[model samples]
Each structure stands twice: as structure tokens, then as C-alpha cells.
Target: MASSGSAEVERDLTRDIRLEVSSSNRSSCQVCKEKIEKDSIRVAHPSRSSNVSIMKYVHPSCYLSSCVHFENSKCKSKCRLSKHEIGKHELRLTMALTSCEGKLKDQVFFHPPHASTLVRQLLDAAGGTEHTFDQLCVSLPQDAKAWARDALSGVDLTGRRAPTVEPEVKPRAPKKKRAAEDDEAESAAKKPRAKKAKASSEYFVEDGDPFCDGDQNDGDAELVD
Candidate 1:
């Protein structure tokens, strides 16, 4: 009888826990082998093979792909609801409620810096002038609440969290305002001779040609060039 009860308890403890968006860059998805970024949604499943409980993580979309049967076969065969379906349904309910708060805050989603989805969702949902949010969380199904608790509690098989992805910053070339100013100054310095001072009488006697022989020769040479 004790052995049977222990087996039942083990079965009960081995279910998938919760869906969460990672708030840390420290871990990668077990399914896609890609870094799960901050604010990106993910899911957790407890491994049943070991005595010590271990959690495996994957992106939300990868849930179906990662798990061979996310929904239990027995449940499907019996046409009964499974813990997986229930957990996901509750998660979506929470997401919808969070989206409501996100809408209120004028954001597509409510995300807090360095905070997990459960924490961010709870805070965003509860931050308003209503106490209904608290009640809503309280009203969550036990399985759903378990998910939230496990995620927020930060329990994992490995003690380490994912490493942060530091943003790459490229060095920019310096703009040369001095070079532009220098160019302008050089252009100004090279200004056309003041219209030859209208052939100043004080400078020289009036010649038949407007330009002197030397000037005319220079002009012809320029035209040839």
C-alpha cells in the first residue's frame, strides 16, 4: 500500500510545471539550442527519471516540438483534460490578463528589467488602482499557481543562471567639423580677384584690350587646358 502511494505521489510530482518568459540571458533553450532572451516566453517541465526533481526549459512555441506528447495520450484517448492542457490554458489566461495591463501601460507586453515573467506579470497586473488583480492571482488554478511559484522561486537543476548578452557597441568615426571649416576658409581664400579693380586708372594706363597681353595669354592658355 505504501509503495503504491509512493508511485502515485511520484506520478503526481512529475508533471510539467509552468510557462514563463525568461528575464535573464543566462540560459539557452533545450529544444532549439538558442539563447532565450529577456522578455521572450518559455516553458518548464519536471523530469521524472531522477529522484531529485530537475526542470527542463524551452521556448513557448517550441513546446509542441520539444515534448513528444505535450498532452497526455491517456487523457486524449479517454477524452479527458490533462495537466499540460490545463496548465497552458491557465497560462494563456494569465497572459491575456497581463496583456490587459500591458495595454493600459501602452506597451505590447508588460516587461520588467531583470525580472521573470511571473513577477513582471504579477506586478503589472496588480499595480493599478484595483485589488481585483490580487484576487485574480488568488483565483488561479493550483497547477497554474505552482508554475508561477516554481518560476519565481528560481529553482533549477543547475545552480547557475544564463549569462547576460551584452549589447555590441561599434565605435563611430569622428565628424570633422574642422575639416569642413578649413575647406570653407580655403575656398574663401581662393576667391576670384576683385574683378581686376575695373582696370584702375591709378594702377595702369588704358590699353586697347580690356586685359593686358600677359592676362590675355593666361586666359588663352586656360581655355586651351
Candidate 2:
């Protein structure tokens, strides 16, 4: 009975978030919907429902982008490093500080650069120099693991929030202006040129010869009564 109880406890412990290398390529990442290749690093979030445990795996970067980082979260308090009030709508990094029951008891907000520094301090306290980033992430507290990975990796969280929709600036229509110009051009093209009337003494002539009056010759040759 003691051995059986120990095995059950071990199984229960495995149903938690894990950072590890993939053993097979069969599992697809929940965030990007891509196959996790064998030997690649992956993040797993495990959940139990109706006595069955299910594990969802994602790539490290995908997991950081999808879960760990935020852009539009309002700051509720001062930054941990600067001790200045974070503006209500200002962009900030959020790290949840959870209780032993894994219930979130509080949150720590920081500027992006300051968040990185805090993560490094935590890592140094944990003797993180000897371990790779993945190993250090695994050693962090459960609540800190995701954000720690994000901070260390320098993931940009500025664009992850729900996008603000700006009012569309409809382009000004040029049809009215273009139509006015076209009307002016058409009027100019169709306008008649006024010619000064010539005196009767100026007979119509051929080849600029005033004496060679073709109209007078044709009229004089007409039959008379």
C-alpha cells in the first residue's frame, strides 16, 4: 500500500507546467500549431479533468509570446525597481507572485529593462551561472518560470495587446477638383476665335496676289440676261 501511494503521488506531481526537451515529434504546439521536433526544447502545461491528465506542449518562443508577455495591461501599482507609480495605461511587465496554493496573491510590475534586471538577480540568487537559460527557467518558482524565460530571452511585448482601431482616414476625393479643371479645359478648347471683318476693296485672291481675283473672274464669266 505504501509503494502504491508513492506512485500515485509521483503521478500527481507530474501534472504541472514543465520545461523540457521533446522526446518525440508527435506533439504539436498549441500556440503556433506546429510539430515539436524531437530533441527541441518545449513547454508543457498539464491539466487533469475527470481523472484523465492532458498535456499541451508549445515551443519556448511561442509559449512566451502567447502566455508570459502582455502589452496593454494597466499598472495597478509602482514599479519594483523605480518605485514610481506606473501610469494607469502605460505599458509594463507583469509578474504574478503566487501563494503556496498557487493562488495569485499579488503582482509585481516593472519596466521592460528593469524586469530583465530583476530576473537576473533572481537567477543569481538561485546559482544560475552554471545552468543554461532553460535549466534556470526550470529552477524558478512555478509562477515566475514563464515571465523569467520571457525576460531573459528579451521577447518584445509591445505589440501583443488588443490592437487599438484608429478611425479610418478616408482619402480626400479628387473628383470634384478634377471635374472643375476638365470643365475649364473643355471651354477653352471649344471657344470660337473672333475674326475682324475685311473691307470690300480687299478682294479675295489666290497665292497672296491681290490682282488675281478668282471670285471676281468666276462672277464676270457668268451668263448675263
Candidate 3:
């Protein structure tokens, strides 16, 4: 009975569900407070207590570190996972990201840990704008963008829906007249115009010329002589 119990314990220890991302923004990582930035991956692990399951999120690097904690007197060293172990988890995550459409479909079936999270990060980088996959691919980290491109290589994104960006139309400023036209108008206004001379008939007889007075005086002297 003890041997059977030990075997059962071993089986339970080996059993692990694949990690994924939260579908909504309702939850945060218990360990890191979800300090993970936008366009970054996350991992959600399942824990069961009294037959009820609860999920908690962490970074992939954090999760791996938690699995390899080692304390010793010699060198204070840390253990690392074998290539086979790493490959196994990597394949799981790759499958999860590729098939789940950037979200976890079910809790019972596992694919990769944090697979959906990585996809979600890539989607956020590409969403809500007119950016194509190629345009977005260059903005991300080398590993992340490469993984995203590979995951999407076999899938058709023609029908994929992204967030819509409302088009903004700014009012244009009123156009100003050309400098030549303005200068012409200003110069025309500044120049003085010539006035026409008044005719002799328009003048009043308030004063007479001296030559007309001399002619009158000579006529009066001839009359007196």
C-alpha cells in the first residue's frame, strides 16, 4: 500500500497543465503584480485546493526559476533544466500559441505555457491601427517576433479582426494671399493721385490782376486829357 501511494504521488508530481494568458484584464500576477508591460508575454499556472482550481500568472523566466531553486554550501549554485525538458516545454508553448488564436480555449487540454500570452502581446502590437504583420514584426524583440511569424506562417490572417482606429480630420488653416498681390495692393493705397486744375470761370472775382487795373487807369487819363 505504501509503494502504491508513492507511485501515485510520483504521477501527481509529474502532472502539470500548460500555462496560458488571462483572457481579460481582470487578474494580475501574484508574484510580480503584473509589472509585465504591454506587448510582453505572461504565464498562468493552475493550482487546486479542496477540488477548486485557481490560476495565477507569472513571467516565463520567473516560472522556470521557481522550478529550479537550489541551495547548497558548494558554490551556492542553481540547477538548470536539461535540453529535453526545455524542448518539451518549448514545444508545448509553441503549440499553445499557434492553435489557440491568442487565447486559451480550454483548461483541461494543455499546449504550451504562456503561448496565448505571447500571441496576445503580438496582437496588441499589430492591433487598432493599419499596421500589417510585417510592419509589426520588426518592432518586437528578436525572439518574440520570430516566434510570432513562425506561429502565423501556416495560418491565414486575411479574416483576422483588429481594433479599429477612428480617422481624425484636422481643420486646415486659412490660406494667405501671395506676397506679390499684397505688395501691389499696399503700394496702390500708399501712392498720392494727381488732382485736375480748376477752370478760370469757376474762380470768384474777389481779387483782379494789376494789368487789368492799369488798362482802366490809362483809359480814364485819355478821357481827362
Candidate 4:
């Protein structure tokens, strides 16, 4: 009856706590992407960009690790962010160029990926059949991750994609430092130009051949005669 039930209830509570403690044990190293069982550590929220796939699980440590690169910088380098709000607007500038030079000149970077490991998660999330990456891009928009998912659904195979770029064809070579120095010197030699003159260019006459005028020729002949 109620006599020993109190003790039994306490025992049941103890067992439940122990089981929960054991069940939640996971020892995955988020940074290195390794799993450890006994020495498992709990990672808090990580610094993963929204531009990634859901399948790409980073330990809280791993995700937070890369945020320094992603955060807005006052004088940032070229990346997700930059000095003058480079990445502030967050636009993905993509261009297709077959030649390596063209791609390089355009600063375009392209990489492929693994099918089974990298893409399946993205495809599964997007609800696209495994062959509609480009078509789905319209609705999905700019996330690298969404694009990756679309690509996964579209491609038959996957692995780390290689980077192949068309080199940019420079209409002109980058101005050499030495040549720039010369230009600087020339500019320094000349005084800074005054502000735009109020007078129209009409003040400055064009080069004209005085001899071309019939009146000048006739006057010369008469003088010679």
C-alpha cells in the first residue's frame, strides 16, 4: 500500500536522471570535425554563416572560430566584409569565363563539391529533385548554401569541388610601380590646376591655317604684285 511506495518513487526519479545524463553524452570535436565518445564536450552556438548547408555541422567551437573572418571590419580586407562596406550589401558577384586568364582578371573563384557527403543535405532541404540547381536558384536566391543545395540536387556525383578559373584578360597591364612613380613625378612638377574656369572653351582658339583663307592669299598676291 502507501507504506513502501514513497521509497520506490525516489528510486525511479534517481534512475531517470542517470539515464538522461548518459543519453546526452556526445564528444564530437566541432573544430577538427572529429567525434569522441567519453571526452565529449558541449559546444554552444557556433559562428557559422547562413550561407552554409544544414548538413555541415560545426561544433560550437568550430563555427565560432571563423567569425573573425566574417565580421564587419572598419578597414577590412576583401572577403565577406571590407573597408568601405565591401560585404555590407552582401551581393554575390558571379561570372562565367572559360579562359583562366579571364577568370583571374575578373577575380572569379569556382569550386566543385562531393556528392554523397556535401550535397545530399542541401538537396534534401530544398525539396528540389536531384537535378534542378539552376532552375531552383531563382526562388532560393543568394545563399551559397542554398546554391550548394541546388547543385547537390542537380549533380549525380559529389566530392570536394576543384577551383577552375578563367584568367582575366587585362585590357592593359597593371601600371608598374616605376611607371606610376614617373607619373607622380610629372604631376608633382606641374602645379595643381586651378578650379574650372568660368569662361567657355571659346576663349581658347583652335589651330587654323591662315593661308587657307582666300582673302589672306589675295592680299599677299596684291602686295607681291
Return the top candidate by lDDT. Answer: 2
What does candidate 1's lDDT look like per residue over 1-225, in tens digits? 479889987776554245666778777776677997887666665543347756656665554322311111121121111223322111322121112233311111111111244443433432444432233345445544444334334444154322222335799765799879989999999998575546645655366656654334454454543
lDDT of 2: 0.58
TM-score of 1: 0.26
- For model 4, the superposed segments whose C-alpha errors exceed 4 Å read 1-113, 116-118, 121-151, 154-165, 171-225
Q: What is the lDDT of residue 108 in candidate 2?
A: 46
For model 3, the local distance difference test gives 0.41
Show where candidate 3 strays beyond 4 Å.
1-15, 35-40, 65-67, 70-225
For candidate 4, lDDT tens digit of each residue in 1-225?
A: 465889887644442101011123354443464763443332232122465412222333332232111111222124211112233223222211122242211221112222222223333332435334443234333544454444335454245332222344769766699799999899888977679868665444334655343333354455543
Ranking by TM-score: 2, 1, 3, 4
lDDT tens string, model 3, 65-169? 332111111211111211223221122222111112444322232122223443444445324544334443454445455444443343443443311223357
lDDT of 4 at 96: 17
> Quick one: how many clashes does candidate 1 have?
4
Poorest stretch of ten by lDDT in candidate 4: 15-24
Task: Output the worst ten-in-a-row residue range by lDDT, candidate 2.
Answer: 159-168
lDDT of 2 by residue, 1-225 (tens): 569889987876675345677999999986678999999777676644477767667676655444444343443467666677666555555554233475632344665545565444444433424534465456444555565466556676564431222345899877988999999999999999899987688446467575764444564576879
Candidate 1 Cα deviation (angstroms), residue 11: 12
What is model 3's C-alpha RMSD? 19.8
lDDT of model 4, residue 211: 36
The models' CA-based lDDT, in order, is 0.43, 0.58, 0.41, 0.34
